[model samples]
Target: MKKLIINADDFGYSRGVNYGIIDSHQQGVLTSTTFMTNMPGAEHAVELANQNPDLGVGVHLVLTCDRPLLDTHKTIVDANGDFRKLGFYKGAFTIDYEEVYDEWKAQIEKFLSFGLEPTHLDSHHHINSFGDIPEVFLKLAKEYNLPVRNNMDITEDIKTTDSFSYLIETALKDDQSLNELFESNQTVEVMSHPAYLDKKLMDTSSFTYPRIDEVEFLTHPRIIELIDARSDIQLSTFKDI
Candidate 1:
């Protein structure tokens, strides 16, 4: 059997994002999502997660979008103390691994404070996979006993999917069927950012507008039908891994 985990990232980025994620899970094939504990919509997202008991919620450990939960950091923050944007990570940059470890632990603790048992771990902007950061990420995951979204480089004995793909739009653009995308891997994790457009999202995120399209595609009848008709494909959550 091929297990497919369609995980919606940025669950608590904004009210629009939180609502869209819940809609995708309740009405579409999305089985799991990761929550951004530092965002403005964090509490709202947690409430929604409590209401929807079946949606596997996890920590979307943030390093790029918002301010740290703890005090200002030495390497992870900018002059203004907010997190440096994605461009900062793209360039040659230096970061303290210890700082990353502490901030991420705070995020996980905050998630637990809500009485929600996190299903797994991932990161905002895939920063956890960046230079030497996987060491810290894996360390935290081990301590917390949580699975992770496959980083594709780490060979450690961590729990994760066999393969990870951020190719939902690309696959659709190339007219590739979902089953064909899953054929080669026994387990696959498809990363997605599906949200409704809102003032906060447009102001804070560069990857806006397309999220609206993603919600449409994710909740589309055809996509759900395709998954339902395929007996070989099992829609799963990280908890099941």
Candidate 2:
């Protein structure tokens, strides 16, 4: 059987996006969500996770946008101590690897402080794969015995994983066209940003309107029917692996 993990990224991004993530889990096909530690609606997302323990919650390690919660002098952040979205690409700026590792470890610790164990770990904007970050997260995953997303593979210490496929960004057609997802014998993680558009999301980032539409597509009846028809496809969570 093909196991599919329908995980929504950016939980705790904002209240509106948080609501959409929960809505997808409760009313749609969403099976898991990853949380941003120091984002605006982090506590709310934790509350929602407590209320719905069936939905797997994982840490979404962040490096951009929010202010650094661990250190004040990290070069990754700007003059105001907030992460700069600009110089985030590879080889853009020299980075302090140890400082970044500590900051990321703190993010995971922040998530654990809520009295819940994370099922897996992934990064916000997939930052763990960029510029001296692969080792930091891999080390923590081994220390904590958790699964880091497949975006960065460090070795046997890190568990093997399947990378998530974005429905809209990829050429996979629409949300109902889910047949292509389970073509592999191995587990597959389908990543999505299913959310309602709100003023807060619009003001903060350019990734807004598509999320609003994704909520509609994910909750459609046809998608559910498609799943039911496939005896080979099994809906799953990250912890199931």
Candidate 3:
């Protein structure tokens, strides 16, 4: 059997987002989530995650469109202390490698402070896709003894809901390391954002409709809900394995 870890990203972004994530956990196949340390509702996400101890949580490292966990990088924030408007799918790429590393390290600290035993690391807006960031992120992941999501172009298979069938082909086309990681690890977490669109999310600069639909289809929430609600069930975590 193919074991999978489905992780929801942007936890603690907004109340709507937090509610959606928690509800998805109650109502869907959401086994895990990545917390945004710098967002408004981070504490709320933490509370919910703590309540649902079965849900795995990790750090959603924020380097763009949000305040840096470190004191540097005023470029990422405006005068009001609100993060700049570089939403996902449209952030302008920059080569601020030193700043990125500093901020990411601080975020790791922040996640630890929240008592989140992170399963892995992933960047906000896939910022690691920019110049030199991927190498730096991987280096930190290795140092921290955590797994990082490498770009394997799984998004294409994800779009078709044929992830099982096309994973190997897409992984080969995108990154060989990802294929090796998938093969070697008995469990791997795939970072994703799946939620219902509330006003806050809909009005946000980065709202995308396809992602919502993808969440609905890929999660298959109804089945999971029935199984858990109708029968005794125990969620598997890294510790379990």
At residue 139, what lDDT does model 1 achieve?
Answer: 92
Tens-digit lDDT track of model 3 for 1-241: 3344556778888777777777767767667777888877788888888899888777788866546666656545567654555452254555456766777888888878988798767777776666556677776776677755545332221111112222312232222434453564544444456666666666663755745653554446444543345222333333333
Highest lDDT against the true fold, candidate: 1
- Global Cα RMSD, each model: 1.7, 2.2, 7.8
Local accuracy of candidate 2 as per-residue lDDT tens digits, 48-167: 999999898998988876777776546788777788684555556787888778887898899989997899988888888887688888888888899767776568766644545766
Off by over 4 Å in 1: 170-176
Q: Compose the digit string of candidate 1's lDDT tens values, residues 101-191.
A: 9999999999999999999999999998888888899899899989998864655577899888887765433225665676677888888
- Model 2's TM-score against the true structure: 0.91
Q: What is the lDDT of candidate 3?
A: 0.61
Return the number of clashes found in candidate 3.
Answer: 0
Off by over 4 Å in 2: 168-179
Quote the lDDT for 102 in model 2. Answer: 82
Please report how far candidate 2 places residue 192 from its true position, in Å.
Answer: 0.6
After the best TM-score superposition of candidate 3, give how far the Cα of residue 203 lies from its true spot, in angstroms: 3.9
